[model samples]
Target: MEISWLEQVNADVPLDDEWLSSGEQLILAGMKVPKRRADWRLGRWTAKRAVTAHLELSSHPKQLSAIEIRPAATGAPEVFLDHQSADISISLSHRDGTAVCAIVPSHGVVGCDLELVEPRSDAFISDYFTTEEQTLIAQSSQEQRDHLATILWSGKESALKALRTGLRVDTRTVSASISDGLDYAIQDEDRADASVIGVSRGWYPLHVRYEERQAFEGWWQCIGKLARTAVSVPAGGPPIRLSGCPRL
Candidate 1:
């Protein structure tokens, strides 16, 4: 579906597992054979409701079509429409109180992540922090801990997913740093987007663009570390914005 990422995010839809647990009779009806599946059905159901709002469709949510997930060898999700071979690019993310479903045609090989703020154990930071990251973490001011880690974690995870686009770069090999004024870095501010430069073959060959949209308030530590981040990278050259998704 051709829709703006920003507009779809603002559309209201029900996300409660309880409300969707029984399945919407009108949505699933009697298409039992293959449609009764779990995440596929529920996720699609939720997606349709949200998409419908973005499309401003007068049709009931049940009238919306079903979506199929096609994954790459490494496990990336793409939407396969029955009517066409091209899979539309869609990104899904759910934090605590809310979940977001975003889609961009083929070109939108976008990956998104959300995290809440919370307290943490000292050893927690050591688990994922590389030497450089560890230095940043230790030296970070008390007030800056959550914000600092969130940016690094988000940028790292987001970039990790971005690398899925072409090359399966090692998570340990590449790292991210954020700064408001520093070029090729991100700010530790909520909902701020950053452009990063990373090493590929020992050189900072390309700029990796990533965005951070704070999902909720408070300091979120474990959730921030556990939540998977997605990113896209070019196979052979600089990453280019995909115009649309490819046919599966």
Candidate 2:
């Protein structure tokens, strides 16, 4: 089945706590740092919106407040509705005031990440990436180096999230591969129609090899200066964007 995903910017999130569950509001109040608070709110708002849309529930503030997102022992977010656990899996990523959430069936596993396309030092790359990944970055043109590096790193993060290990595990244990002849500039209209049953248009195929044994199938895309990736265990079709989300 295709995983459903959604994206929301800072402006799309409400400034008030009315949409937040009581537990969530208490958690928000405990955050002291300004940026951390803002990022947490943005992530929660995005995740709630994605969950509501995926479950075909109402998006009203009262309804949203009934949905709670709490962290598990592993620090991964878990979804609860009216204090009951929801049977779904979701992964969230936020960067530069923008957040994305990917949802899959309860029995399925998924991980997603958003990263800014920027320069990384050789030491940074060598420290985290596998030798093959470092070689891929080294062979890329100077103009594409930053973007390539960002995509590679973002894919690793996604895979790590899927594994529920986050950065706790050695990143070098996973290797990412981008498709050949990828067109980063493909427009929404220029790509395949939404009715098509395959990888979405404008998104490129990506494969992540883990521990020289387990493999993950996923997709990646470049949106402006940001790189986004989603990986799943059983593999997923193109992401189905959830409609009716708020925008500002």
Candidate 3:
């Protein structure tokens, strides 16, 4: 199945539970507080605003309520909705003024992440990346680190979303190696680790795409990993070409 990607920045937005309760909300690190809402409220509301719009449900406010995130028996985020049954999986993330929500139809898991392009301090880098991942950064050029950080953050967050664990899992254990565009290679963990990461884990192809929100000036991206079992062929090979990869 083809993955869907959507991006938007709302000039007039007010973050509130009324807006957030409807759509699954994600809050990042930085965001300005709306007039009446508290600081924490705005962060989440802004995230909701972006997510609802991405879902193409902004036109109908009530539809946001249709998207719900209730804890599963395993304590992971599981989407439950009677809105429209196209079989959608959603992941929400936000930081500062930027937020992102990714939805994949009829897919077991999906993830989306957005990050402000900021330089990482040596200490911060050391804290976040594992020894192996640090080696990759040390070998990278200045330009590569600046750009790759986004991929690193996005890939990890996206993976967490698909895994439905959010940040409950150790960040360092999940590593995403993006040589180009965005694809994932789990560095810190093995196949068993992937299973604990979410309802459907292990190695699955991730589709990632991003756009810079001018208003938020943040990079928002979408990622998806297709889950399938009983493979006709060995794993780690090219996907079976049904017709063709669809244009998102």
Residue pairs of candidate 3 with colliding backbone atoms: 22-64, 22-65, 28-94, 28-95, 30-96, 87-106
Tell me the deviation in Å of residue 198 in model 1.
30
Q: What TM-score would you give candidate 3 relative to the actual structure?
A: 0.54
Task: Please estimate how well model 3 matches the true structure, expressed as its whole-model Cα lDDT.
Answer: 0.43
Minimal lDDT window, size 10, model 1: 194-203
Which lDDT value does model 2 have at 193? 23
lDDT by residue (11-86, candidate 1, tens digit) is: 2333433223233434455556652334345445445544444444432422354333445686565554433444
Residue-wise C-alpha lDDT for candidate 2, range 11-126, written one tens digit per residue: 98887889999889999999999999999999999999999888988899998999999998888888999999999999999999889899998898999999987799999999
lDDT of all the models against the reference? 0.41, 0.84, 0.43
- Per-residue lDDT of 1-248 in model 3, one digit per residue for the tens? 32333332333344444444433444322334553234334333333343454454543445445555554564444455454333555555544433334444544455556555457788877887656567867877775675456556556666555555667767775665544332232132133222234322232343322222101111222222211211111112222211111112
Ranking of all predicted structures according to lDDT, beginning with the best and ending with the worst: 2, 3, 1
**Model 2 whole-model lDDT (C-alpha atoms):** 0.84
